[model samples]
Target: MNRGRQLFGTDGIRGIAGEFPLDPASVYAFGRALGRWLKQQTDQPRVLLGMDTRESSPTLVMQVAAGLRREQARPIFAGVITTPGVAWLTRTMGFDAGVVVSASHNPYRDNGLKVFGPDGFKLPDQAEQELEGAILELRQAEPQPLTQLEPLAPQSSLTDAYLEWLYSHGPQLDGMKIVVDAGHGAASQLAPRLLTELGATVHSIGCEPDGRNINAGYGALFPERAQQEVLQTGAQLGVSFDGDGDRAIFTCSTGRIVDGDAVLWLCARWYLEEGWIANPARVVVGTVMSNFALEKALAERGIRLVRAPVGDKYVLEEMLRHGAILGGEPSGHVIFLRLATTGDGLLTLLQVLRRVAATGDDLATLVRDYRPYPQHLINVRFQNRPQLDNNPAIQSVVEQAERKLAGRGRLVVRVSGTEPVVRIMVEAESEQLAVSTCEEVANAIRSAIESG
Candidate 1:
C-alpha cells in the first residue's frame, strides 16, 4: 500500500465503495488497529460506532465491529446517526473513542471513517499518524482468521441520547413554520423527527434516502431547490443539511440563501446581546472566503474576526486556540464550540430560529446587517494546477487588476485543494466590475498555464 495515498485527506479516510481505502478488508484492518490502540490506552475500552444512511454503512459497521471484538474492545452501535452525534455521544457517555461511518456530504456510493477522541474532538494529528502506522504494519503481517474473530452484539439508542440532549439545551421551535432539506442522507432520519418534536410546523424535502441519491443536487451544495420550496410554501425559514449532516445552509422567507458567514454573524450578535458571550474580547473565527462585510460588522461591535484556513476543522482549531465561542466556514458548517464539538446543522438552524423569535425581526431584516459586496468566482479546469503567480505574465496582470480596482475591491486566485481546478475570485463595488475583473484574471491564468 502507498500508505499516505491509500486513505486519509484533510478530514479522514474516504473514497468510493470497493476502492482501495474504502475496501472492506482495509476498513476491517483500520478497525482492528484502532481497537489495539484503544486497548493500549485503557483496559476493556469501549468505543461508540455510528453511521449515516449510506447503503454501504451497515456492512462496513459490521466489519469494523468485528475488528474491535478481535482486539477485546467493546463496540456500542449507534445506528443511523449523524457524524456530530457520534462525537457528542462519545464525549457524553465517556467512551474511550467514537467511530462514524460516513462520507460527509459526498455521494452515497462513497463512504468514510472518522474517529473522535474521548473529548469529542477529532483525533490529534500525532494520534492519527500512530494509528495509520499500526494499521499499515498490521496489513503487512499475517492476516487474522475470520472464524477466530469475535463479534459483539450491536447496541442502539445512541441517537436517543443525542436527541434528548438536543431537546434539553436547544431552543424550542414552537409556532415556527420550518422546512428541512435533509439531502436524503444521515439527517433524513433525525432532522424531521427533531423539528416536529420541538413543535415546529415542519415541511420536509429530500427526507427520503434511497441508498444512492444522498447529496445529489438537493442539499447545501444545491440550495436553489430548498430556496424555491421556502418561497413557494411561504415558510418562515428553510434549512438544508449535507449528506452526513455535518453542514447546513439556510434560506429566508424571501428565498435568499444565508450562508455560514451570515449565520455566524447573526448568532454572534445574538450571543453578545444576551450576555451568553460575556468576554469583551470575544472573537468570531472565519475563513478567507467570508465576506469582508462580516469583519467590518464584527469590528464595529468590538468583536474580533480571526481568519483561519478553508476547512471547518481548521476554523474549530483556531476557535479552540483563542477560546472563541463561535466559528465557521462559508460552506455553512457553523460551530458553537460551547454546544458541540463539531458542526451541528440542526442545532444551528434551531439557534437561528430562536434568535428570530426572541427579537421579533424577520429573517431578512436580521441578516441585512451586512451587505455583501458584489463578488464573482470562476473555476478553470487544468490538467495540472499551474503556478500562476510565479509566471511574470500572470503576476503582471494580477498586479494591474489590483491597481485598477485600488482599495474598492479585492482579488484572490488559487488552485482548489479538493479538485483539479484553479479558482479566481473578485469582489468589487459593482457587480459588473466584479464580473469583468474575474473574467480578465481567469483569461490571464489560462494563458499562463498553457504557456508554462
Candidate 2:
C-alpha cells in the first residue's frame, strides 16, 4: 500500500480502476471510513450512491456499499444517475452523504469517487483529509472476499424525480430547434428527453452508452462533434454535456462554439437587465482559467469578477463567500447557485435559453459584443513533481514574469491538478505579446525545475 500518499485531489479519489487507490482493498476501506465518519454524524447513516456509465462503476459501488454495510451504515443506491442528481437527491431526499462513482470526463478505464454532504456540496478539503487518514488506517485490516455483485436497476421514480425538478426550473421551449449531445454518459437518456418534453425539435447525438463509450469522441471536451451535428441538423443551437452531465458546452446555429465564459457574460447581462437584483453588487465568480475578456466585459458593465482557484468546488465556495448567484469555469461547468447546488449541464442550458428567448437574440447575436482577449497557454511537463507554489525558484521566476505584464493583462502559472504538467497562461493586449510572455514563463519554469 502507498502509505502517507494523498488519496483525494480537488474533486475526489481518482485513478486507474483496480489500481492501489481504487483497488478492492482501498475502495472497501474508503467505504468503511466514510461509514465510520457518517456514524458520528447520526445514529443511522444513509448514503446516496450514484455512478456514471462505466464498466467498472458497479463493482466499485458494490465494494463501497459492502464496506458501509460492514460498519452498520446504509447505502441508498441511485444507479446510473448524473453527479448533480445524486447531490440534489442527497440534499432534498434526506441522505447523510452522497457518493458519485464516476470520473466526470475521464475514460472508461479510469474512475473516481466524489462525496457530497447533506447540503448538496462537496465535502471540504479538511473533511477529505480526514477520510484519507481513516482509510489509510483501516486498509491494514482488510476484510475477506465478498459475494457475487449483481447489476443494479435504478428506481425510475428517482431519475424521474430529478428530471421533474429540473423541468420545474426550465422555461418553455415550444417549437424551438435544438441539438443535444449527452456524450453517452449518465445524461444519454435524460438530456434528449428533457429537451423533447420541453417541446423543442431535438436532434440527438452521443446518446448511446455501451458502458465504455462515455466521453469518447463526444461531450463538452470535444464540442466539434456537437458542432457538426448542429450544422447538419440546421438546429438553432447545440449543447454538449460531459460525462456525469455536470458541465456543458454549446454551439450556435452558425456552428461556432459557445464556451462557459460566453455563457457567463450572457447570463450575467440578462440577470442584471431583468432586475434579478435591486442595486445588486453584480458579482460573478470565475476560476483563474477564465479568459481576461470576461473580466473586462463585466467591469465595463459595473460588475465585479472574483477569480477563485481552479475547481468548481472552489468556485462555489467563493460564490457562497461573496454571496454571488453566478459562477463557472471555462471547461463548461457553470454554477447557478440559486437553482442548482453544483453545476448542471441541463440547468445551465435552460438558463442560457431563457436569456436568449427573453431577448429574442440568437446565441451568436448575444455573444457578438464579447470579444476574446488574446491568450496563450503552454504546458510544461517535468520528470519530478513541481510544487509551483512552494518552490522558491519557481516563485521567483513567476514574480519576474508578473513584473513584465505591466498590468496590461494577467498571467497564471499553476500545476495542473488533473495531469502531470505545469500550465502557464498569459493573457495580453496582443496575441504576439501573449505568446511571447507565456513562452518566457514556460522556459523559466523549465530551467527552475531542472536546476532545483
Candidate 3:
C-alpha cells in the first residue's frame, strides 16, 4: 500500500480553506507544481480551472492560477462550473490537464484541489506523489507573495460545448415535471437551466448560494427536503446534487427515497435487458459500503457484484479492471463508464430519467426488487488521526465484533478519507441486530482509540 501519500486523500488535497495544504502559500505552490508537471508533459501546457460556489474558491483559483502562470503555463477559466464539467471540457477541448477548486460536498469554509488528466480521469497515484513532492519543496522555501494576475473570465463557448455533449446523450423529457435541488453549490446555476432546456417543468430548490450556505441545509445527503418538495410540487421526479455536483440522490413522485443502490440495480437491469452488455453474467462494481442486498440482486440476474474500497476513484479503478460499464457508491456517486470517465451526477440522473421514460414506470416501481439489508452507520470523531486496518487495539475489537456477527451479518470499520472520523457500519437481517452491533462496534472503537 502506498501509505506515503499523506497529502492526497481518496479525492484530493482537502482541508479548511486557510489551513496547511489549502493555505495561500501552499495552494499557490500546488498550482506551480501542477504547472511544472504539465510543462514536463508538453510545452506551454493549457490547464483548465473551475470552482464551486464557496467563498474560498475564487481566492484559491487566483492563487493556483498565479502559480501556473509563474511556471509559464496557461490556465483557462471555466468559472463556477461542476467538477465533471471541468473534466469533460479538459478532455474534449484538448487541454493538457484540469484542476477543480472545490471540495465536493464539503462546507463553504472547506476547499480542495483535484487534478485530472487530459482523458478526464483523475491523476494516477504516481502522478499525485510527484506533484506532492514538488509542492512540499516549494512550500519549504521562502514564501513569495501571491502575484496579482489579470482577472480571468470564463469562456462561455466551453460551457456551451460541455452542455451540448451532455444533452446529446440524454433523451428529451417533454412535459415532464421535475424538482431540482442543486445543493447551493456548483450546480446551483446550471442544473435547473439544463432541465428546463430539456423540456421539463422545473421547480428548483437550494439554488441560492450565499457562499456559506452550500450544503448547510441542502445536498445529496439531505433528501428530506427534496422528498417534501416532490410531494408538494407534484413532480414526477426530484433530484438533489452535492456541493460539487458530481454526486446526486433522487426521490420518487411518492416521496420515496431512491438512493445509489437502487440506481445501480436499475442500471444493471437495463443493461442486461437491452443486451447492452454482451452477457448477463457481467460484473457491476460497488464499494464496501454498498448494501449486501445489492450484491444478491445482481447475482440473481447472473451478474456479479465486485466491491472496491469506499471511494468513487476506487470504484472507477475496479470498473476499469473488470471492464464494467456500471459502478456507484451508496453516497450517490454513480459512474456509467460507457458515457463518462467519472461519476457524473447530472449524467447519472439523465440516464435514470431516460430509463424511467422508456419503461413508463416511476422510481418506486423500477427499484421495488432491491430489498436492502438493515444497515446502521455511526461516525466517531477523533482528536487526532485514529489508527485503523493495522492497529492491534482496533483490530482486536473488530475481530471480536466479527465473531459476534458470526456470519449472520457484515461489519466495516474504516477511517473517513475526507474527515477526521472513523465510520462504523453494521448490516444484518434485523434492524435491531444491526443497530445493536453497530453501537457495540462504535463504543469499542471510541474506547480503543481514546484509551491510547
Candidate 4:
C-alpha cells in the first residue's frame, strides 16, 4: 500500500472516498488500528461513530465499525449527526473515543475521518502519529477478507436525546426573524428545528441534501446566498453553516458579513459583561489568518488577542494553554470551550443570537464600528518544493516589506499545509500597500522556484 501520508491531515484522514486512504481496505485497517489502540488503553472500549449526510459516509462507517468489531470494541452508531455532536456525545456518554465520518466543508465527492478523544477534543499529535504507525503495520500484515458489515440501527432515541440537550441549554428566541442555510450537510435537520423550538421565525435554505450537493455553492463558503435570502425575506440576520456543521458564517440585516472575528469579539464582550468569563483580559485566541484590526480592537477592550497557527485545533490548543474561553478562526470555527468541546455551528449561532437578544443591538450596529484592516493573500502554486525562508532573495524582499510597514502592519509567508503552493499574506493600513507588499514577496518566491 502506498503510504503517502500513512493517511492523515490537519483534521483527519481526508480524501476522495474510494481512493487510497478512504478505500475499503485502508478504512478497515484504520478501524482495526483505532480499535486495537482503544483495547490497549482499556479492556472493552466502546466507540461512538457519527456521520454526516454524504452518500459514501454510511459505507465507510460500516467498514470502520466492522474493523472495530473485529478487535472486540463495540461501535455505537449516531447516524446523520454533526461533528461536534459526535465529540460531545463521546465525552458525555463516556465512550473511549468518537469518530466522525464526514469531511467538514469539502465537496460531496470527498469524505474524511476525524477522531475525538473521550474529552471531546481532537487527538493530540502523539496519539495521531501512533495511530498512523499502527495502521501501516496492519497494512503490511496478512490481508483480511472484507465482510458484509451492517451498522446497528434504531437511531431515533439517540437523535432525540441530542435535540433535547440542545433545546434545554439554549434560550428562547421569542420573536426573532432569522435565515439559516444548512449547506445541505449534517445540520440540515437540526438547525431549523432548534431555531423554531426557540420561537424564532426561521427561513431555511440549502437544507435539502440529495447525496451529491452537500457544499455545492452553499454554506459558509458562499454567504452571498444567505445574504440574498435574508434581504428577500426581511430577516433580522442570516447564518450559513458548512458541511458537517462545525463552522458558520453570518450576514447582518444590512448585508454585512459577520465572520468568526466578529463573532468572537461579540461573544467575548458578552461573556465578560454577563460574568461568564472571570478574566476578561486573560486571552482570546485566533489563527494567523485573523485580522490585525481585531487584535487592536480587543486590545482596547482589555483583552489580548493571541495568534495561533492556521487551524482550529491549534486555536484550541492555545485556548487551553492560556485558559481562554473564546477562540475561533476567520473561516467561522468558534470554540466556546465552556459550552461545547469542539466548534459547533449551531452552538455558535445560538450564542451570537443570545448576545443580540440580550444587548438589544441590531446585527449591523454590533459590527459597524469594528472594521477589518486591509489584507491580501496570494497562493503561488509551484512544481517543486523549496525552502522559502532560507532563500536569500526571498528574505531580502520580506525584510524590505517589514521595514516599509514598520509598526503599521505585518506579513506572513508560509507553504500551504494541504496543497502544493506557498501562501503570501500582508496586512496594512491601506489595501494598495497590502496588495503591493504581498505581491513583492510572492514574486520573490515565484522567481526562486522557477529558476531552480
User: Candidate 3's residue-wise lDDT over 1-452, tens digit each?
Assistant: 23656579889899999888898889989988999998888998999999999998988998999899989999999989899898889888999999999889877888999999999999888898999999999988837656565668888888788888888877788979988888999998788878878888898999999889998889897988888999998999999999999988999988888888889999999999987655334999999999999998898888899999988889999988888899999999999888888888899889998898899898889988788899999999997777676678778878987888886789998888888889999999899999998998898889878887
**Tens-digit lDDT string for candidate 1 (273-358):** 87866665688899877777788888888898998866677788888888888999878899998899988887887788778878
Pick out the ten consecutive residues of candidate 1 with the lowest summed lDDT: 142-151
lDDT of each candidate versus the true structure:
0.83, 0.87, 0.88, 0.87
Better of 3 and 4 by TM-score: 3
Candidate achieving the largest lDDT? 3
**Root-mean-square deviation of candidate 3:** 1.5
| Per-residue lDDT over 1-452 for candidate 2, one digit per residue giving the tens place of the 0 to 100 score | 12244788878888889987898888999999999999998999999899999999999999999889889998878888899999999999999999999999888898999999999999988888899999988887764445665455556788889999988877788878988888899998888888889888888889899989999999888999999988898899999999999999999999889899999999888888877633356789999999989998999988999999887998999998888989999888999887878998888988888877788989999999988778888999887777677778777877877888877788998776655588999998898888998988899889887887
Q: Tell me which residue pairs clash in candidate 2.
A: none
Model 1 residue runs over 4 Å out of place are 1-6, 142-154, 379-406, 414-423, 439-452
The candidate that achieves the highest TM-score relative to the unseen native structure = 3
Candidate 4 residue 166 Cα shift, in angstroms, is: 2.0
What TM-score do all the candidates reach, one by one? 0.90, 0.92, 0.97, 0.93
Q: Give me the runs in candidate 4 sitting further than 4 Å from their true place.
A: 1-5, 142-147, 151-154, 381-386, 418-421, 443-452
Candidates 2 and 4: which is better by lDDT?
Answer: 2
Q: List the residue pairs that clash in candidate 4.
A: none
Tens-digit per-residue lDDT, 1-452, candidate 4: 11245577678888888887788888898899999999988999999999988899999999889889989999999889899989888888899999999988888889999999998999987888889889878866836547688866736666677778778777788878999998999999989988899999999999999989998899998999999998898999999999999999999998898999988888877777777666645689998989998998888877899998877888999998888888999889999998887898988987887777777888888787789988899999987778886789989998999999888789988775544578899999999999999998888889999988
Candidate 2 lDDT for residue 152 = 51
Lowest summed lDDT window (length 10), candidate 4: 1-10
